[model samples]
Every structure is written in structure tokens, then in C-alpha cells.
Target: MTRSTRGGAPVAPKRVTPRAQWTRGSPGGTAGTPHPTASRRRWRRTVIARRAADHVCETFGADGIQGVCGHPEIEVALAEFARYTGDRKYLEQARLFIERRGHRTLADIEFGRQYFQDETPLRETDVMSGHAVRALYLAAGGVDVAVETGDDELLSALRTQMANTIGRRTYLTGGMGAHHEGESFGLDYELPPDRAYSETCAGVGSVMVNFRLLLATGESRYADAIERTLYNVVAGSPGEEGTSFFYTNTLHQRVPGSTPSPDEQSPRAASSLRAPWFDVSCCPTNVARTFASLGAYVATSSADGLQLHQFVSGEVKAELAAGHVSVAIETRYPDEGTVRVTVAETVADEWELAIRVPGWARSGGLLVVGDSEPETVAPGMARVRRRFAVGDVVELRLDPAPRFTYPDPRVDAVQGSVAVEAGPLVLCVESVDLPDGAGVNELRVDPAVAPRVADGRTVVTGRMARFEPTDWPYDPEAEDVDETAAFEFALTPYHRRANRGPATMRVWMPCA
Candidate 1:
């Protein structure tokens, strides 16, 4: 029997003649420990999953096929299987796939070899290139292989690539990919608001790579990157209601787009607004998986104590050399800066507790330890070691004020414009908030006026100007347009925009 993929590609089941024995540890699947038989159900589906690991390891031999698929995914899947089933051979196979890339073994297409990340070897590549999601995924798999094989050089190269990618290629929302064409990464500092092709999958891929690096390096910077991307891109993909999702996240909406039909899958261009469904359907499932396994990214441990990265309201328990430690986290986050951590249970003393203070807290943050006065802490992990007991509380306060943020001068798209941000959330001006017949293009905001949160909404002081249409947009005789009514309007979170209905929105506000 055959199944049709979202892309209309027909996939037929492959029958393996039982040539290779399924073993655990060093070689194959968990033979001694069957995974509860649920994962073993449905022979055909099981074959489909097993075939991906077995056939690829066998088929991609040096004498047979030396190339990888256009999209680099199987490498990471094989590595995951190795981790789950205790098979080193699967890890080796994944390493082989990474090693074989960059040789241009696959024939080139119009988009060029870089589109599939074949222009440079995994080790040689610095700064992500080609399709944003594919480049990130390939790097993620490369990190996986490097971690398992203890390859420091490979890890170092990937770290450099990630830093450069995040610095130059990423958006204010931590969204990646600049060009609408090829769904690929643009040149350094080429980020454009209206043309952003920030696919939700690419955001997920960024988190995946950063998470691996975070685990390998134990650096809080990687955790910072993960938090930014997760709060913006991943959380932004889904609409207010979980029923709809966006295929590509656009930083600006020039035109008001009608809601996508629930029955049909939408094209990338049709996604000015969130769609109920799409043919490719990558965003929904990708988002679903991310949300399901989100706890994995919440907290991690070092040799001595516990480290809390994300600031969501939850309870956490960790076992260290000292003893078992449990704490409950309570925070509204992004909306409010205050985070309260109460010690639920602790068996020992001097267990180091580290909480991440976001880089965006420019002025500095405050950390309160068990009724002590709030002490200023810089960006990075705010750590403290002390004896703890029941009913003890620790608090972290971040600056969640609405402020104007300027972009790099090299970013020509919004060079003179300023965007509004309230803590970790990027705020935007929606057309729905403007007066009748007013457009976002004619909106001019004054940077001199400080923005403030009023009634839980970010209010910015701005004036509406009139742009008279002309046969030629650019003319030497053009005069300064009239600045109409001066008033204050509320700005919505970038992730929460477009839920009211079809609306035009822009994140970077034009300076008057």
C-alpha cells in the first residue's frame, strides 16, 4: 500500500527481507527492551520507520550513492533513533551522511548547490547559507554527530556559524530567512520586514541547534537564543485559537489579507494572515511537537546544581549530589517581569540555583533572595548558593517597559524606523487600531515621546499624516505632507496580531 505525502508525493512501503538482525546497543533497535509494544504496533508503519534507518545505512554506501537528499532531515532522525534505541551504528550512519555532504554529489538545480547546503562541507561551513530551515537542520544533525563522536572542532565551527547567523541573518522576533524567493537566507543584514520568509520550521530548527549547543557547552547564551525564538516565532505561528496557523511569518503586512479557507492548504504567499490548514502542514505539526516536548528546553542541570532557563509558571524537581531539590515557578512573564520561585522541598544545603536574565533587560535586572532586598544582576545566569528549607521564596524582576528599539544601520529595510518592544515581546501597530481611513504607511511616530503600558496595552504617541497619491512616487517638487490628528494608540504583540480579522500591520514604526 502507498500513502500520499502533503506535497502530493506518493510513498510506497518497502519490504525488507529480514537480512539484518535487529539488535540493541552498538548495532540496532531495542531488542531486549521493547518500547511497551505500542511503538511496535502496525507492522507496515514499523517497517516504514525501520527502513529509514536500515536502508539509508545500507544504500548510501561509498560504491553506490554518495549524495544526500535535498532537504537534510534523515541524518538527525537517525541520530535520534540512536539515542532512543541505544544503537551506535545509527549514529555512525548519521555521521556518514554529514561527512558525505558538500561534495556536490547531487546534481545542481537552478537555485544552486548552496540551496541544499552542498556547496561547503559540514565542518567547513560558517554562517548559515541556502534554505534557512535546511541549513539549520543540517547544522543540528552535524552537532548531534559531533557530540556523540566527541568532535570538538566540528562543534566549534557550528558554534561560529550559529553566532554569525543569529547576529546578521535573524529578525527582531528571532525569525530567520529574509528573501521570499527560495525561502532561503538573505545576505548578512538583509532582513526586510515585508519580505521576511521566517518559516515556523526554521524557528524550530534554530531552537534545535541552539538546544544541542546549550547541552554541549552549558552556556546560557544558547538558552537566551532559544527563549527569544520560542517566544516569538514558534509561539507566533499559531493563531489566538489553536485551529489556525501561519505557513510563513511576515514581519509586516502591507495589505489586509482575507482569512485562508479551512478546507484548502495555502501557498506561502497566501499566508499574510494565519490559515486554518495548509497542504505542506509543516507548521502545525512542528508547533505541536515543539509544544509537546517544550519541557525538555525548560531546565537543564550541571554537575553541582539546577539551572532554570525559561520563565514559565511551573514546578521543577532535580536530583543533585547534595540531594533531591524541588521548586515551584510562578510568573506571568513577557507580560509581567516578576518571577517567583518557591522552594517546595530540599534535602541539602548550598545547592547552586541559577536563573537566566534576558539580554534585553538593558538597564539591568533585580534578584531577590528569600526576603532580602532586590540586588541588581546583569544579563546571563544569576546564581546563588545557600541552605534552603520549605516556605523560602526567590524572586527575579525584569524591566518590562515599552521602549523604542532601533535596528542596525545596515538593515536598509527599516533603517530609519523604530520598533516597540515590551520585555521579550515585540509590539506592533495594527490597522484596526487606527482611525477610519487611516493607513499604517502614513503613520509617523515621535521617538522623543516615551511609550508606556496603560491598561495592559502598550501606548505610543504618534500622528497620522496624509500621503496624496501621485503618478510618480518620487519627485523633486514633493512637499512635506500634513500631520493630521495627534493621538495615542495601543500596540499589539507581534504574535497576537491578525486575530481580529483582515488587517494591515507593521512592527517597525516609521519615525516622524
Candidate 2:
């Protein structure tokens, strides 16, 4: 698994490597010219972020007292913007609002409570207050900033609140957030199959807040929750097209033609397509902020070494006490688990590189590659402690095979259905890839048959399935029968679903 940098012979570190050389101008000074358009786009993104922050601050009261405005959603937006942009002004505004307008000493905002709509205060004993804590964590720049600023009071307060929330709310299935309306959390241990909220945005937000806390405290629990959320909840939120977004991500889907009204007060059924952006509009912008600030969440450094949290194709430059060390991480992740890390311009010193071998990957018997024979990093995490090297390269590989996953038995909608996944992407059967209206509720797949990639799509041919008409004979027991029909169907990555056309799509399909 190990590949030598140069012909198996240990090569001496050069003052300038290929990457450094490429970064610098060539002899003619014509190379390494910066792209004006690229630079402008980056600047424009910053501008837009700043403007958004300003708008949020201006629209909401700056003093933090209950304003004429109803809820703290605007403040949440402002605080999140501050987290990414590193704007002190926005942070201060967020702080003032939370400290002043927020509920008394120990209480925070409750989901769907009067405070959320009418600005009425509520008790925050141990509610699954992920949303409010998320806003507070973002406004305060996470746990790291709190520690650095020596605000032990605020840090302890937040940690206590979050710990209580996490300890009380998490389901046996590891799901959090329990209310479908306003996507809020319910009272202690109140998760039910048909009532579980577990909104995709809430999962993303909870993970984000936990990530910041992990970075600050170097705790592993936060990272564990993050992986769970990423693999199960967040990955299921997007449609195949990567455009339409799910407001709620259920483990199951409601039968076709049984769609519920917006105010029906029921958990949404899982589907392959995203609903239109909600009036709350938290998930879309939440996705944008997560992607935009992803770099900050990848790795961390101290006097000792670096910790690689997430694996992707990117380079991280850290400033160590000895000098500057740039680590380039090249990997085909979530697709193929091979990851390579090349160290450059690093002084000879003992350092540690920690890699997260996802829980699923470990169970599948993946291997990590170093200079010697491959090593098995346990699922969840693996760490390598080694001495100095300027050009040392490390590679790790995980299992990357397509598999089908069934919903937790408690989730009613997907009881007999299953989802297809490869690497990190969840796949779905799209109606556009099927034959006209025949693709509607009639989609069914044989569990024993494997789907193959053809014409840039994953397709399956199996026994036919039937969808009851919009208005048909109502018989719950009859709908579960496996009719001896057959049809060929194709699926796409969930993130790329809606891009093709208006078509019914289903992530969970009946398994024969």
C-alpha cells in the first residue's frame, strides 16, 4: 500500500518541492500568475457574507432585549455569519442579544415556544435545545474562542447546557431532535417512530456545534456524533439532483398518494426529492455555511502535531514551533477510501497524524498504509505517532462497496424498503430514469440483484411494483403485496436527483 516518493530510495528534502515551486513564480516570472476572476469571486463571497451579517444585525435589535421582532432566527443567522467571517462586530452583537434578550441565567430559547414566535421567555432545564445552543455556540465562536478569551463562565455554562441536552435527547438509534413542527426537540426521551423529528438541518446544525466544541476541547465524542450525523442524516437530506433539499429526513417514506399537508403535524415521509425551501429556510443556508467554512473543521494543530478530522482532497499548512509544515491530503474519499498524506517543509520532530476510520469502514476491515506493511486502524479512529520526516507519505484505504441499508425498525415509513449507498452518497431511484408514469409508486427492486452503473447512472431490472392510484381502493394490507410485475429502473446520486426534470423519486424502495 505504501508508495515511495522517489523510486524506493529515500530522497533528501529539497529546499523547494514541486508544490512550492508551483506556488512561486518561475524564472521568467510569467508562471504562477493569479487568476483575477477567481480572486474576485472569493472577494465577492466575502462581501455577500458581510452584507448578510449586516442585514441580520440591522433587522434585529442590537441590544439583545426582546425587540418588536418575533423570534431570534435573525440573531441566529448573524451569529453563524460571524462564526465563518470572523467578524468581531457581529460576534459582539450576537453576544449582546443572547445575554440580554435570551431567557434568564440558565434558560435558553425553546423550540416552537412563545419565545420562538411571540418573544415570551421559557425555562431551559434540559430540553433538546439543539437550535438555541447552536446559535449560542456559533455566536461565541465555539468552545475554542471561549477558552482563549478566558470566559470560563460562558464556556462552563454552554458545556453544561449542551451536555444536558445531548445526554437527555439522543435516541437509542442515535437520532436527535424530535419534533416535526419547527423541527424542534421534544421532552425527555420522547422519540417515537411516527413522531421523530430528526430534521436534516437539525442534524447538520448539531454536528456543526459539536465539531466546534471538539476542536476547542480535543474531545472525541463530538467527532463521533459528527460522523453519525454526516453518514446517516446529512447524507440523506439532498435529492439525487443536489438541488432540491429535504426539510425533514425520515428513515421511512409514506406511501405514494398519501402525502400529508404542511400543518398536519406529522413526521414527513422519506423521499428521494427535496421539498421546496421552507419559510424558515434554515437547511439551505445552513448547508451553504457548512460548505463555505469546511476548511476550518478539517484539521487542528498545537505544539505537538496535527489532527486530521475529516478526509478530503486538500492541503493544510500549519505553523509549528520549528517552522512551517504543509501537509497535502489527497484522497478519493466517500467513493474510494484511499487517502495519501505527503509532508513537506517540516522539521524533523515527533508528530502525530490522526485519521478517522468511519465506524462502517472499520467493520468492513479497511487498512491503513504507512512506510511499512499496512496497518488496521480501528473503526471510528486511528492514530500514528512517528518521528521527523520532510517527505514522508502515508496512505489509508477503507472499504468502498455498494450496499443496501434498511431503516431502523422503529421508523414506520420505510419498514419494508431499503436505500442503496456507496461510499458517502445515498442513491435513489428517479422517475426520470424510469418509464413515464410507470415509475411512480410502481418502483420495486430485488434485494438479491445488484445495480450496475450504465450511461453514468445506477440502474436495476427486477420484478414490477405497483403504486395505488391517487384515488383507489384503500387497503393497507393489499399495498404490501409483491405483484409479479417487472420493470427496468435507474437511479442517480441523491445529490444529483432533481437536476434532470420533474419526476417522482424514492430513496427507499420495497425489497423483494
The CA lDDT at 493 in model 2 is 64
- For model 1, the local distance difference test gives 0.81
After superposition, candidate 2 runs with Cα above 4 Å error: 1-180, 183-204, 219-289, 362-369, 435-437, 448-462, 467-482, 485-488
lDDT of 1 by residue, 111-195 (tens): 8899999998989988998999999999999999998899999999999999999999999999988877778999999998988
Query: Number of backbone collisions per candidate, in order?
Result: 0, 16
User: 413, model 2: CA deviation in Å?
Assistant: 3.1
Q: Per-residue alpha-carbon lDDT of model 2 for 1-512, expressed as tens digits?
A: 12111122211111111111112223331223334544655555555666665655666546433443333444445555554444556666655455443343333344433323222222222233534323333333434345434566766665665676666665323456666654556665555533556666666667766775665566545665665566556655655555556666543333333322344333243433455445555667776666676666677765645666677788887765566777889987766678888886576776655555655553633344445767655654455566647778777777756677666565554577777776556677755565654553555678877766666556676566554454557766556765655655776665554555455666677776
- Report the lDDT of model 2 for residue 390: 71
**Relative to the true structure, how large is the alpha-carbon lDDT of every model?**
0.81, 0.55
| Residue pairs that clash (backbone atoms under 3 angstroms), model 1 | none
RMSD of 1: 9.2
